[model samples]
Target: MRLSGRAALAVGLAGAVLAPVTPAFAAPPPVTADLRADVDRNGRVDITGTGDQTGEDTWSAGRGAVFLPNIDDDAKRCRTTGPDGKPLSDAKLAKCNDAADTTVNGAADAKDLARLRTVPMAQAPKDASGTVRVTGKGAKHARLFIKRAGGWTAVTAKTTLTAAELRAGVELGLEGTDVVRDRAVWDGSAVVELKVTAGSTTTSDKVTLHVAPLLTQHHLQRAQRMLVTEIQGKGPFSRAQQKFVKDLDTQAKKAGVKQSTVKFTKYGDIWAQDFVEPAYAGMTGEDGRPRTIRIMLRSAQPDREAGRELFEKLRGPDMGVVQVTGVKDSEEWTLNSMGNLETIPPYTHGGRSYPAGRIIMGERKDTGSKPAKAMRTLLASQGLQNPLFLDTSWLHVGHVDEFVQFLPAPGTPRGWRIGVADPDAGMKLLRDAKAAGHGKTKMFSVKGFEGMPAPKETIDQTLADKKLRADNALAAKRIKANLEVLKRETGVTDAEIVRVPALFTRGTDEGVAADRMPLLRRIGGSADTPEAVREYGQQRELGKPTGPSVMTSAYVPGAVNGVLLGPDRYLAPRQWGPVIGGKDIFTQAVTAAYRKAGFKVSYIDDYYTYHLGMGEVHCGTNTLRDTTKPWWRP
Candidate 1:
């Protein structure tokens, strides 16, 4: 009976009809259909057999004073169509505003008013949360009301208003973009400003609003299981094996996980694609939704020419290179230098070449054309407009010196000294020992010290006594010259060359060679064992486990967690131990390069295994919208 936000009403005045009451104390007399029909054309169709107060109005008002629906000349032009789609002769559509298009029957008579009443009013849902913050310029002139118990309550009476008042206080122009409600969005639209007022002043607070779901999120728990097997790492799988792997991946897709094919180049062909499948752009995943996978290729050598070439090629159409003229050669050289390289000479170990540098290339996959454009086409290729040289260093081939530059901005000094303390606790022990000076520590007697002052077994001593530096320098010079030939042969620049650092430890055909005690361990088990080799193959099909492993040295920056600059580092897959190990070197270096390029980086080790290598961290995590949730839950 109350006047809600909607513009329709229900009228049943039987009580007033039964008793003759005064006009002020009684309800307004119900108009009769016959009288209404005389004054109005539109009439209520009693299809539901509802009562029609045609001539029941007991009170007869002054004939001249009585008012009727304004059935004007323009209103007469409009008519209501019947079920047969033909206009009714007795009724015509009402014309409230326009003379064309939208037309409703005029409520000239009680029957017409009854017809008007038959036009259903817009009612709120049974349970509706009616208040919503307005967004964008659409908030201007926007008026909404609170709905409670299936009825709209006008919190602001006469809810419609001008743009200024509609904004609630602030001025908002209505010419900008319209507001849209995006359910999947992390942050809602940026329109209404949020502020906290204190006394006469107001301070702007965080204005971004996170869209909360109307329903609870579904969570699932996962279990871990170990798998073991042995098989040759190579080639096109049997149809049966492929089907089996496909089934497993299908299951993984349903479980919201990913599968990857890891191929160790050392075990077979170097040219084998890591993972291959039909384009996923049009593929529907297990959840009956489109599947999206982002492939991030990272290698140890940031300056790997081949890798860079491939990356550039993948970047597609926008393959034009950026050249800064008059830029200092040192800066240019630093920027283009191959990222990861060997720290020591005789770079070859175990009949494999340790890349003097590392380079990695990759692409991010998506179901849309945007990611494809960034990864496959030439649109918005480079994320960082002008990448600054973060740091550079070399190994035994040269001096272990490094240079690092920080972004020039407020509160950040242009440059600062960076140190490389061994994460392996070696540097900590040395510092502790130095702090607790000489006399406090017991020393072994010189008499029992082997070789009195120095051990003859030291590789350093042996190399020095043999004039190894000069011989090694000449050998390195020859290797460099040979590299020049290889470079010419490959047409790859020295800056693109990748080098691998030697591993101090090696793993035997048994377990990790019984002597190595590296704090960090790469996930891939050694290929030396037949069992390990088989397990590696099975893992390729089953997918790698999400786990962490040991890593050699990591670069450290004050503000950045992933990037680092130290004496020297290198990566290689073929060459094992004290030189080059497996492919992780490439992955880690590539991850680091991205960090230096201004992208946030996170490391997840042992995500999966293929052939004899482990999957990278980036391969496991997927980033959605950049809406950040507060870490601390209240």
Candidate 2:
């Protein structure tokens, strides 16, 4: 049989699977008696056979060679009869000559060394001079890759072999047969590629690899997404909005951000400044029961210094709702005083007396003083130690612009309906006129003070007026104006800011005629048809039908229901104009903001009699551990 270099390499490789080559006809076969009796080693019979014994030893392993004991003093050669016994092919004769021509192990000649030199090596890449390729059955797999001199170049897997593997020559194969037809070639300085397929799966073994560029990797890891909070009417925030700000620090910490980074800013003290009542009615709790609220106070507004710090610490953790609180700072008042607030029991109302109160009554009657103290007491009762104040009074709750812009828009619940009221009488007059119809006269009554008795309205004329539609435009303006103020204060211009239009200041009695009243009044009362009343109070019918306004300045049921059920659109009503309770409003607003930002949210539902009674965290815990060094505290 003619032995191909490929086949020889394969057989050779089969012997040492680590890195093998095929077999060659140059080696003498074992089992021959001629070579066996002429035993070179003492006491050993080295029988060997010449190859190409195809017909003679077709199915047997030891057929061509045999050994027998010899009694002669000198060794003798054993010869086989030509075609009678084991016939040797010309290839076999040449192989015998080659083996006989050489020492058993370097026992003989120059011809054997020359034959070894003729073995071929697996080739590298075609275009690339240094690249080499190799393959084998159960070959030790290794991945190879290169960074091209100038730029990245994609190459096949098989073309590149490791330098170490290249140093030690390996056998190559194609479809299990030893062949050079399927090895890899180089492609210049660019990467050389090769592939080996087994079954249906192929791995990137022996690939031309490269190093990654530093510049591109750096920017990809660090890039932020701008959100804007919309303002409704009057000031930038209510007390509840402030509360959200205060709690943001805690929220950030809980979300795993560093404490110093999470922070807030005070716009104006809710206590010190006179407040504007929210433009809607609010809920009437289980009759005579005091409502619970919370807020956050801060000494400074969160800026870039704080922002960057927060950004680094926040990393990817999510912040839930922020909270705000007002801090009352007066030399005369002490934070530790137990008698600072008065507790009131739940009073009976709507034929029911409910349980309530860790009610704190303060001696100072200042509305500003009450909110701060109430907040402090609330937080303290909740076991919050070292809880620093945000800022006093002026708590405007907001967040980073990027965070808000990414938040999804608020959605309405199914079966949602609209209700309206005019905390200000402007909307009421328009509603009454619309109900009264063109050019009509009607009777109206106004409540009187003390024993003076109620004033009887003998005649009130209603003009059939198209100008009555003015209320809608005014309401829209109020919402727009409110939002504009917020936008200016926040510096968050990215989000789309759309205002709810068509609300007006309602008037008491047949008081100020819509025509006689000044064009811009924010509050008052009105006597309109109940349906008109509903329309005005809810502010839903003023324009294209929209969602109802929940809480408002007006004392109306529609507004109350809105605050409870339609949390997304409720307006926080201030109790006494300038001095108002803000904890509830701020809390809800902050919660809503967080919900918008893709956070997992749920109500704080703990037994917070003492804590909540003063208006504090019913659910959240402060996760901000002290990181300050001992020396820093002083």
How much lDDT does each candidate structure score?
Answer: 0.21, 0.21
Root-mean-square deviation per candidate: 26.7, 34.5
How displaced is residue 303 in candidate 2, in Å? Answer: 12
Least accurate 10 contiguous residues by lDDT in model 2: 211-220
lDDT of candidate 1 over 96-147, digit per residue (tens): 1111222322321111111111111122122211112335532431222332
- My TM-score estimates for the predictions, one after another, are 0.20, 0.18
CA lDDT for candidate 1? 0.21
Best by TM-score: 1
Question: Candidate 1 clash total?
Answer: 54
- Writing each residue's lDDT as its tens digit, candidate 2 over 105-195 gives 2111111110000011133222212232323321212111232333222224434534233323322211100001111311111121233
Q: After superposition, how far is residue 112 of candidate 1 from its true place, in Å?
A: 50
List ranges where model 1 is wrong by over 4 Å: 1-207, 210-258, 262-391, 394-462, 465-634
Error of 2 at 625 (Å): 21
